[model samples]
Structures are given as structure tokens and as C-alpha cells.
Target chain A: MVDIVIPPLGEVEEVRVVRWLHEVGDEVQAGEAVAEVECEKTTFVIEAPVGGRLFAILVPEGRVAAPGEVIGKIAERAGGR
Target chain B: MREVFWIPLGRVGYREVLERQRRLHELRRLNKVPDLVLSLEHNPVITLGRSADPRHILADPLALEAAGVEVVTVERGGDVTYHGPGQLVLYPILNLRGWQRSIKWYIRALEEVMLKVAASYGIQAKRVPSRPGIWVGNEKLGAVGVYVRGWITMHGLALNVDLVPDGFRWIVPCGIHGAGTTSIATLVGREISMAEVSARVRAAFAEVFGVQVRVRDPTGLEVMAR
Candidate 1:
């Protein structure tokens, strides 16, 4: 199991989760964008860290997400999912 | 200090300019071009940011279309916003890789640039406690929404210069209610030329970001942005 958290946005205390590209039970490829987060200036997509199935979504759209806060959980896949 | 290439694209359509930003962003990511600051004006348009609430768009879809205003869903941050001729928009394709890398720092810098420009005109512009853009008294003077791809910035700030704020009534204007949008011309009680405002904006950007602005012919087609 792996955790997906909000990446640090320099000097920004928190970001709003703009949207989720992947839902629970969806397969996400490593480096694929799984969620979008909006900071002060820009809205950036957060990529999946590993190829796996999305186990859970802790942060939904329109919610504030702090840096290092886990937004979702992923079940890592071996070889291929 | 390093310099950012200043390209004045004059006036253009919003979608056309957005396409240029994407192309330049790719070149920036590959290091094929230096940092760029594109200054220009946008034709009338309404854009919905990544987290924009559709309800904020108060204009009827058919009416908006009949007026020849294009509505687009953009990838930038912020809520619903309006852009039109007479407004000055700056899109900085900066590689923040070595700089602060903090979104807040970058945003504050953009606001500071506008603040200084407004101050030069004797207009007192300030950043509200938690809001992201510059304001004059209770009216918003500027709006900022950006998209950073791999540390390269795009879809930047738009300052109301001489545009009639009537178009803004079609939308809620960044999700805020009651408050109004004011332009430099409106505050200064005179018509300010776009050329003059553009010059001040360039100087302010240099001062706030600690970079020099050197005018150069854009290498490619006329790029547009807002």
C-alpha cells in the first residue's frame, strides 16, 4: 500500500483540491496525474507515485488539502495491474 | 540578475493566446527559449478556472453567445473571471526552477508588480488579508490565475486598465459578491493609454521580480494571452 499526499507548494500553507482525475478502484499508472490542486497562483496536477489501483480518496473536490496530508491511498501493483 | 524577454503582443483573442502559451511552455521546459514575459490585451471572453463554480456565471448561455463572447474552461487556478479589450494582461513564462519555487512567493511578486504600478499612478493598491490579487480600496484592480507545468508558469494576472466593468456583471467576478471591479482609468478619473500602462507594468515587473526587461521581437508568431 502507498499513500498519495499533497506535494509542498512553496510558501503556500494549503491548497484546494480542484478535482480528482482518478477515483477509488480506478487503475492509475505511475507518473499519471491523479488529482489537481490549486495554490495561490496556479492549479497543478499531482501525479501518481506508483502504478496501482486507487484504494481510497481522503480529499474530494473543493476541499482544502495541507501539504504532506495524505489525499488518497493506492495499492501498488506488481509487474502490471 | 537574469533578464526576462519582454514580448509585447499587442491585442489578440484569448484562445489564440492560450495556444501560444502552451507552445512557449513546451519550449521553456526544454530550455529552447529564455524566460519570457508576454504583455498584451485580450478580446472579450469569460474563462472558468479549475475550481470555478458554474453558478458564478450569471449570464444566460444564449445571451452570452449572441454577444459574441466566448466562454472557455481553462486549467488555471481561481474562479470565474472576465477579460476584454482595454485590460492589460501579463503572462510570464518563467522557469522558477532555481528561484523560490513557492507558489505563494510567485503570486505575491506578481501582485507587488501591479501594486507598484498602481502606486506610481498615485493609486493606493494593496493585497487584502487573504485574497490573492491587488485591490484599490474595496474594489479589485487586478485578478491573478496561473498554471505551472514543471516549474514553468503560464496563464497569469490581468489588471483592469480602461475597460468598462459592465462585462464583469455577466459573471460573479472571482466568486466575490457585492464588491465591484475597478480599473486604473476609473480610479484615476482619466483615460490611461494602454501603451503607458504597459510600460509601467514592465518596469514594475522588473522591480518586483528583480529582473531586467529587455524588449525583443518575439521569435514566433504573435502570441496572445490574458
Candidate 2:
């Protein structure tokens, strides 16, 4: 499984998961924005690292998350969706 | 010198300007346009940033509608804030790829611009530690919220020029309760033209961001060539 972590937002102590763009069991492509997070001054879209099914969401909308926290996971795909 | 294009929309509605910003941002991301600073006044409106708490909007919906104030939820960061005539709203559409990639640096730079503008007007505006806006004593003088997609920015800072602070009671400005708001007019004890403040703000922004801002009319010859 590929971990979808909140990348470091410089000097931002924490960010809130604004929303999940995709749901668990949804097919996601590499570099697709799976979730949205907001720091103090900016909103960022967290992208998937690999193409697969969004396996789980560890953070939900409005929940605060820290840098490097894995907010989601994508299961490796064996074949076509 | 690095350049930022300046587009002035005299008095615009929030939704219209936001759509324009998104379109401009897409063009900027594709390298179709240079960095842009859009300066304008907004009709009375309350905007909620991406992570904004809805409770901060204290105005009743029916009353707000009757007052012609529209509340919109936007994609920028921060909480809730107000905008209207006499408030200069600046949306800097910037691509941070070659510029500063750190959001913190970008935001601080924006505050510096506002602080300098306030200083020029002889208002003692300063940054409160851990808070992301310009304040005078206990009152907020400016608010900032930004959105960056693929390192390109939109929805920048707003500086209170001559706007009445009473309207801000409709919301907890930036979600900070009891955070009184102030303006250049109130501090200076006189009315200042929006054009005057706009000019000063443009200069401060150019200086702080280290860019030569070329003022452009959307349909002017200079911009048409671009």
C-alpha cells in the first residue's frame, strides 16, 4: 500500500483536512489529488503517489492533521480497474 | 527586475473576481501569463476561507440578505472575514516555482507590504505573534488568506482603508473573537481616497516582492501585446 501523507507545509504546525476528493475503494491515478488540506495561509491538494484503489482515509474533513501524518492509503493495483 | 502585472477592477463583486482569479491562475500555471496583482474593491460580502468555522459568521442569513451582504465560502486559507467598498482587496496571482516556494515566507512578505503601507499612513500597525495579520494595538488593520495550486497563488490580502468597522460585527473577523477592526481613515482621523491607498499599496507590494509592477488596463495596448 502507498501512504498518502501530509507533506510538510513550511512553518505550519498543523493543517485541517478540508475534504477528501476521492473515497475509499475509488480508483486513483498517480499524482491525482485525493484530499485537500489547509494551512494557516494556503490550501493544498494532497496527491496520490501511485495508481490504485484508495484503500482507507485516516483523516476526515475538518480534522486537524500534522505534517508527515499519513492521511490515506492506496492499495497497489494488480490489473485494470 | 522581475515584473508583476497589475490589473485594476474598480468595484467588483466577490464571485466575479474569484472566477477571474481562477482563470488567471490557470493561465499563470501554464506560463501563458506573468505574475499578476489584481486590486479592486468588493461589494459588502463575508467570505469564509477553506478551514473557516461557520460559527464565526454571526449575522443572521435573512438579515444579511436584506442588507445586501453575501456570504461566500472560498478556497483560500484562514477563517471568516469581511470585504466591502473602502477596503482594498488584492489578489496576487503568483507562481512560486522560481520565486519563494515557502508559504510562510510568502505570507510574511504580504504582511510586510501591509505594514509598510500602514506606516506610510502614520498608523502603527504591527504583527501579533502567532497571528497572521496586521494589527494596531488590539484592533486588526489587515487580513490575509491565500490559495496555492501547483505553487501558483491566488486570494491574497485585504487592507482596511476607509471602511466602517461596524459591518465587521457580522462576523468574527478571522475567527478571532473580540478582535476589533480598524482602518486608515479611523486612525488618521480623516477620509482617504481608495485611489490614494491603492497607489500606496501597489508601491509597497512591488517593493516587498521585489517586482516591478507594470500597471495595465485589461484591454490596453500594453496588455493586448502580451
lDDT of 1 by residue, B28-121 (tens): 8778788988899888899999878999999999999998889999999988999998899999999887567788888988898889889989
Clashing pairs in 2: none
In model 2, which runs have C-alpha deviations exceeding 4 angstroms? A76-81, B164-166, B219-226
Instruction: Estimate TM-scores for all models.
Output: 0.90, 0.91
Q: Check candidate 1 and list the clashing pairs.
A: A10-B102, B17-B224
For lDDT, the strongest prediction is: 1
- Candidate 1 i-RMS (Å)? 1.3
Give the top-scoring candidate (DockQ): 1
**TM-score leader:** 2
Per-residue lDDT tens digits for candidate 2, residues B70-117, read 999888888889999899989998987757767888889999999999
Docking class of 1: medium
